[model samples]
Target chain A: MNHEKNIIELKNITVRFDGETVLDNLNLTIRDGEFVTLLGSSGCGKTTTLRIIAGFLEPDEGEVFFDSKNMNGVPAHKREVNTIFQRYALFPHYNVYDNVAYGLKVRHVPKDEIRERVMEMLRLVNLEGFAKRSVAKLSGGQQQRVAIARALVLKPKVLLLDEPLSALDAKLRKDMQVELRNIQQATGITFIFVTHDQEEALSMSDTVVVMNEGRVQQIGAPEDIYNEPQNAFVADFIGESNILDGIMKEDFTAQFSGHTFRCVDRGFAPGEAVDIVVRPEDVDIVKPEDGMLKGTVTSVTFLGVHYEIIVDIGGFKWMIQTTDYAGVGETVGLSIDPDAIHVMKKSKYSGLYGDYSTFSDEMEEMNQMSEELAEEYAEELAAERTEEAGDGAEEAGK
Target chain B: MKNRTFLRRIIGAPYVLWAAIFIVIPLLIVVYYSFTGPDGSFTLDNMKNLSDYGQIFKISILYSIAATVISLILAYPFAYVMSRKKEKTQQIMMVLVMLPMWMSLLILTYSWMNILERQGIINTLLGKLGHAPLNLIGTPAAVIFGMVYNYIPYMILPIYSVMSKIDPSVLEAAEDLGSGSFSKLYRVILPLSMPGVVSGITMVFVPSVSTFYISQKLGDGKILLVGDVIERQIQAQNNYNMGAALSLVLMVLIVLSLALMKLFAGESDENLYV
Candidate 1:
């Protein structure tokens, strides 16, 4: 909550690889003891930004300032920052104790002090008696704790975590999210996390910076980002939204889906083209005769807490999530409050999302399946390389 | 299920037969000859005669150890450099390392002889450069040089393979934790690559200790090794008993050294073999 001064600043940063721009004219600043997340999809340059901050990468054109001092030409080892890699790159040869003590040993800290600090960090991460355990023998979650302890033992000014929990199961990931937030608050170290999971970002980050295609779409608190997205991409990416093309009639008024509605957004030119965002949970289901806009329910799915119904209104599908039961082929009406309707200026991402016409549960499942398959393929490739190396060793032995 | 098991056994019959014929039978024959006399009776004479060639044994052990150490020192840095290159460059460098192995060992040793002989290419070049012609061949150094040059690829391959498999992120993590380049290598890279180093030493030392061709040509027959003596006893002197005895001793020595290495490597022995 302390927004007094900037701990780190990146100005006009541009990075190009193989003649392709990965980050373009990007600028960002982080405050001390803040938990900021850079959220985006794959190839959206979130990891690249984290790497730039970690000093593993250098921007082609940019100025990086740490504590208000220009940090150009500083190597990663000379900086006061540490990174937790995606795979928890612990030294396989070292046990948990040695891994945590590596930094202290490299600095030639006193042995007794090193042991005390290492044990203290282990206690912080809840790995007290696991100092002698081999890293490979530990479970994924345990290894994650060791990696955290290793980096935080150095007491870095800033901790950069690049999707540290992405490899864990869903339930464990949720637990770690809360644990990570507690750790950040307890230690009061600046944490700059990078992840592609929007839900993870929204739940954990004090400030979420939504990114798309090498550009910052929006930056705000989680509630503000979810409720009042500045653009169509931010609205669609943050959660499910019913985005429709609309015209701003005047201040506090908008027209969409052949009906004018009252909204809280304003300051737009008269009759300006815009995008209107309607959250699925904000719409109320009513009888068709007493409703504002009437529609026929096309599909209904029970989602544990609510029933998600897709309604067809004037040939456009609108998703509504409510506890009310709406059967398919039944006529229904939707009621929208003025505060529930969010309006924004038109962006390049307009019309690219926010439609449920081609959406299905199977399609979402298929997307998850493909991601799992890609992960499996990468693991298989690594196994194959290890086998090849084994074969090479045998041949050399012969 | 029974039928599939039968089929699997049938498919594996050839390898079993090949091992019994080529490997197992030959070893048994060596063991037999090692303990028998010329009259086909058991005797301890052959084992006792080994003490007479103590000098040859010492020379062979010393030269091979020297060769193995030199190869390791030269190949570690080279393999480390090669492993850090881009993929395309790494492949090219790997191919270059293996290209010399495709030729015959005798041919390679002959080539080294031509390069190191008194009036060969190196001496000729030195003479033309207005320097006195140094004694380039028929020395212990030339024999060690030949052994190193011929077997260095074995040392490089395993080390390079293991080094290349080291996750780049681990090195980055080391740097992130405030380790300089030297500390990173000494603490992280070297310890991780120990399996490769142990295997490389084994691969280089085994053949160098038992090699006959390099010492014969490069040593000018003056610096005889255990292999040369075994070869002379079997082919020229027709003394298979003494030859088998010497061969058995060499095998025992190699196995002992390998066991020592595995012990030193500790838990990393899981990765010592394929």
Candidate 2:
């Protein structure tokens, strides 16, 4: 028997598009019956990685293993996996039942058996009465359900979904996401979903692999990736964060935003530069002088369950979400838990998320200065264009 | 309510007039001629005299069907290859295929004569090699050959247009769904390209049924087809009524062929849009 526990393993995966590296050397392992989600921003190579795993694309340098077998020569059909594309890709001429029966028919299964399996798959996807209905006759949500039935009827060992809900409306997308998770549970099949939406990844995936610029930044459970991000990219990508540039003081305390904050780890030597990443929800807003950092609320947004507050702390604008409402321009204090700060080393991948920890005041001053300069440049360009147009009008009239 | 508007009525009047004058008039002429007798009386003489027209009907139908089937066999491969070409190459190839169409078919027929005639280029080459000149000129082979060569573009172009519109992703999807080469061709490519094949057959067959030029020029006027019979009746025999009657018969055959083509293709308008 094949050792199917480690159903899919991608080692040192790398992909490039027109000389731009989309996936750096990446490694991932998906266990049998485990639901994994590749989560990242658009252009982060998460979909590229998924396509490579699905055998639609070949990695520049990597090995994809299925059940300990090197899958280099195995075509997508030969491999024990099926994909449900984002567009659904249903055969327009075929009815729902015929589409589901296609894979079985290709396998040369008996006609009666193909019907039985197709019927069963339809039932599984809750599309029982849709057998004779043409695929084009179905709504988008129904078409997606037909696509699910079509892919699942083959009983593949692993199913790859490339942002299957991305085409649906918001309510339908959410409903389908839950239904997808429940279906995966019912089938007990491995599902590797690729998506840019973090909340969808968090909701559906047993393990979330956050990627950026073709390299995986972090891979962990949803809660772990959110609560304890590995790097600055992860922290920013997984959720909203307030970053601060700070210098490590004696014994692991860092000074930033005109306040001293204690941190859990003390690896950095005294006077060394580092960046502190704290999620917006983790920062406590309070009355001035009663917190570690001083700030003024610039804007407040109600996000249904919480309030998202943009605060000007020292000169840096920090977005902090709280249940407490604060008026614009109101003075506020910022307090972070000692273990909340995530320190990141300076790397080329920095500047992707704006440098959060510099003097908050200096950062705001620089931002305002840049904004003023930008306005002046735009005005100058507009004036020059108007002058050119005036000269042209006179020339034409003459 | 909108149908009663002055502008709508004004616009619609011309179309109805045109249909009645140009289309319905000719169709009535054909139907009347089909039912008219030899003495200009309203009788079923033309219909009863179908036995006399049987040879024309059978030959035209058989030859047109044969030509369509042959053109399909030839065009399928060309269409497949052209559709698979890169964009620039496909454009260049399309231009090349359409180049012959720019030249008159009569001119092309003369060119074929130059190559196909006895003691012509083909026979000259064979004779130079010490064999007798082959009697290929005044044969059905020559007629079919000329028909297929001239109308091949008609077959290929329509098939190419239809085949090229088929999504490559659908083919790939089929492969990923475990379809081997044969099954993929039969299941996906062939079914999807039926519209083109249907259009191509209609294009080649309709004109081929009444095509007198190829049979006249290539068959040396000895080979009897419906086109030859019509030409003889109208020009040599000086029987316009008989010619018009036969013309009506051919028109009816074309209409019937069109309906048959639609039935055989079995593709809906929705399938084409998709």
Candidate 3:
């Protein structure tokens, strides 16, 4: 990104909290007027990144620059940036008008201008008539809107929101997510929002930076992140992915799970082991003989418009989606396009034991143990029901 | 259920009856006496008599108000520092504030007497600075100073309690909104901690009004507050009816002062009570 378009650049930032490194050598460039979301699961340091940008936490290793200005020693209050906290920290003593007018008042804007700006901001949030109402009297969504209005009224170059809608109910959260995106676009300010919900991030952000364990996993547009994940973590964290371990055979053919398949994602040495990730919706169900792989249908689920099928292919369970009917215990065929097969270099963090062969052996043993535990629990439940029935029968006879 | 509730009420009735007898009945008696005359005749003479009592009442009110105000001004910073400091420091400071509270009022008054007297350490130090012994004892200032010193912890504790409950996030939010430190103090900290301020004022004022011991002791038996007047009328002069009427009048004044304070302090009293 060009320096003019990029409002903030954080390079090689590292943060350690009580000897535990929370953010480690992270670099990110936030462009101007773009709604970028730091999307990740819990313990992902996404919140820490937002806090660091807000100047609440200082990095131990690197520098943060905002519009070519260094932000090394600037306190949060002195920074040009404004933050909307998760709790919507509205001044409880101030009503809606005063709360909205707070920043302008601090700036010593003329009274008439403060009034006009607050009124204009309130109208933007559709809270025009609520000037005299106490902030405590507003609903959760209203308070969040007021918080955003307050931050925006300051005309800050960068607006940082730390899970602003996480406190609302599901329906309200969804509504505010749309409202927030519209507000950001209309205001044309850089929005650095933090959220643990992948769905929210994917739906609202122009760009999503996925993070995990104090590191950036991937940074891309929603479609790019969803369609072409860079690694197993990105593929697994963003959405449901079925991974199959395979080996390249120098002829563009991959072998795995008792089947051979062609792959288009090349540039790998022959005999190199790789993990192939295929979305459940990408799997094609066809005739048993025509399919590249055959499996027994273990379960079929009707989820609104789509049908989800769980197939057991030679003791390896794979989730597949198909519109066709596949009953339990019936053998089915599954096929995938070579282009749809995403190949990732197997990672060390997957905790796979020893070599790939040992990994497969351990997986089989784990599956057997799980099955035996389930059978044992099921028999115990049956025995309890039988004893209760016997007691009822004896009482009836008596 | 009705019988069980009745039984529970019966078991708890003695404490309630005791409260009514000791607290409510005496307050009612004070009210009654304030309305009666010296000759056992029902009249508002005691309430309206204010000729001798008026000047004394004014002096008493002025001295007490001044003392309470000064005490609050002095106690706030001390209480704030104590409340904001580390746990061990706060505890030690609190114990020091509470030491005067644990000591008897009469003993503390004598201690003040020794400190404020002509040949006391303060005067001796001033004399060492090439000045004559300054007059401090046997004055209204001494009386006010004694009351304030004795009752300062009463002011500090309630205010500290209120200040400690104020969420630090509220102040940070104010700062984030671009409020300077002074504005944040005036808007957020002061208003949010009003309950403590109001309660501290009440704690200082109510007792200081009828506090005759420090006045009589420190004033060298010359200053006569309402409490002193009532004590003298009943014990020294042997005029029980006049004493009762004066006591009743004093009670009414205290109640009115409290009501006025509440009305002025605005909506925070109910929150503190709850």
Candidate 4:
């Protein structure tokens, strides 16, 4: 965390495709030897930012500076950066050693030196005995390590990884996360990782950058980002939270759900509308008579570590994670401390998320089904277009 | 399940019968005719006579090899450019390449004859421009040009399909790893496209070597290829024995050449379809 002296700076970057803006006017800076992650859902411009830093893409309306030098018009090969593509992109024709040594061989490095460096990189990625093995035969996790070794063998000043662990199974993904963090630390090269998985970002990154709709929502350490979210989007995206419309009454006081509560956040005008974020694990279950607000328990699910209960509070559903057992028909009370309630200013994302009324295990399945359906629909459209073009070719030939 | 198996056998009966009648029977007849004389007695006279047509075999091989090489040189760059184009443009280019193929080969060669003849369209244009008429028709070059024009599509289609299937991310990865344009092509693209090159060479070489019409129409009876000699023996001279023997030798030659090509393209054979 003692990082200083910016290594990469992006100034007012904007990118557009097909007359639609993919990345808005954005600005960011990376320090030396810092593990930074751009976390967002799909189509949120996270990969676009990584491409800009890797020199594969040039911003339409901004300047990029690497090591305090303007990097405009510089090609990817000439830049002191390497990227691990989303699919690993290992050369199928080459073995592991040849793939890792490709960059050095292209630069006409000595054959013996190439072999030595390639073997060292193989040892780093734990693929020392796989030098002569073909890349196509390796499993997904092994291929990912080969990609990492190939990029790091160049010894670039920066490494950009675009969702490198996304293709692995869950257990393998976790193992690789720890391995990647260790590799980044050992190499001390500035690592810029992009992924849509917030948990991965939180666990691996020294600095987490939350993005939404092509704009930066918040940027801070993982703890700060989790404990102190700036808006409803960050709070809901990071973890489960009960977001409600509240009003700031005065200094250190907020009014929401027909109860006035004391919170730590301040510096707001009197009687201003704001959003309140209460984490599911922060509140404590207690007796109904001693509770600040009373609620009826609607549903309870047995998770491994805790029980997740949904309560109806003044016709609004609130999700609570607690270790105590609560029946579906029982009325429960909840209590919160002053430090537990987080208040945020109203933003464009307010009232859009953080509602548990439609929350269920079935909802997640339905969302997955719809996503698959949408992908199938898109594939059908592409197939139809290709068929039509083929018919046109036949007709023109006649 | 038993009924389904019976039905499958019934459906495949026609193909088996057709192969017996048209393919297997004709091949047996060819083998029989190659070993017998006109008097219906086994003899090696026809096989021994093959040495007399050695010069014709050499000329045929030389002309077809030239045709195959020229077609490859012309089609490789064209297919590479087409593969790099957008989908719409690529489809249009494919149509243009196949357009010349839909017409009859005789008609296409006849049209080339009209274009390349001394007193034809080119000569007429040259006469108008006050330049001497260049002799183009009835030359070895004309026959080779005709073979190349007729078979170039076969060379282009396979190469283009293979090149277009290359994952674009692999190229970007090469660029990211400090490879320039030429290096990327030499190291990655050329090796990956070897399967297509082999298939294209085979497609062009097979037909040009055994072609009778192109050399007959464009060579104007001067360039006697193996196909023309075989046609003369079987149809005009009624010498089926010599024609069948010549066909057997030609088949052996083609098979040997294909085996050589497969040896050169050793491990890439696994991904030939891919």
Better-scoring candidate (DockQ), 2 or 3: 2
TM-score of chain A of 4: 0.90
Q: Rank the candidates by DockQ, best first.
A: 2, 4, 1, 3
In the order shown, the candidates' DockQ scores are: 0.39, 0.54, 0.31, 0.42
Cα-based RMSD of candidate 3 = 7.5
Select the stronger candidate by lDDT from 2 and 4.
Answer: 4
Residue B35 error for model 1, in Å? 2.6
lDDT, model 2, position A27: 90
> What TM-score does model 1 achieve against the real structure?
0.91
What digit string (tens of lDDT, one per residue) describes model 3 on residues B174-210? 7777776788778777777787888888889888888
lDDT of 1 by residue, B1-274 (tens): 9999999999999999999999999999999999999999999999999999899999999999999999999999999999999999999999999999999999999988898888989989999999888787889999999999999999999999999999899999999999989999999889889989999999999999999989999998888999999999999999999999999999998999999998999886442221
Q: Order of candidates by lDDT, top first?
A: 1, 4, 3, 2
Model 3 collision count: 0
Model 3 chain A: ten consecutive residues of lowest lDDT: A350-359
Most accurate candidate by DockQ: 2
Q: What is candidate 4's lDDT per residue for A135-223, written digit by digit as tens?
A: 88899999999999999999988899999999999999999999999999998999999998999999999999999888899999999
True C-alpha contacts between chains kept, each model in order: 0.76, 0.48, 0.48, 0.70
Cα distance off (Å), candidate 3, residue A312: 4.7
Q: What is candidate 4's CAPRI-style docking category based on DockQ?
A: acceptable
CA RMSD (A), model 4? 8.4
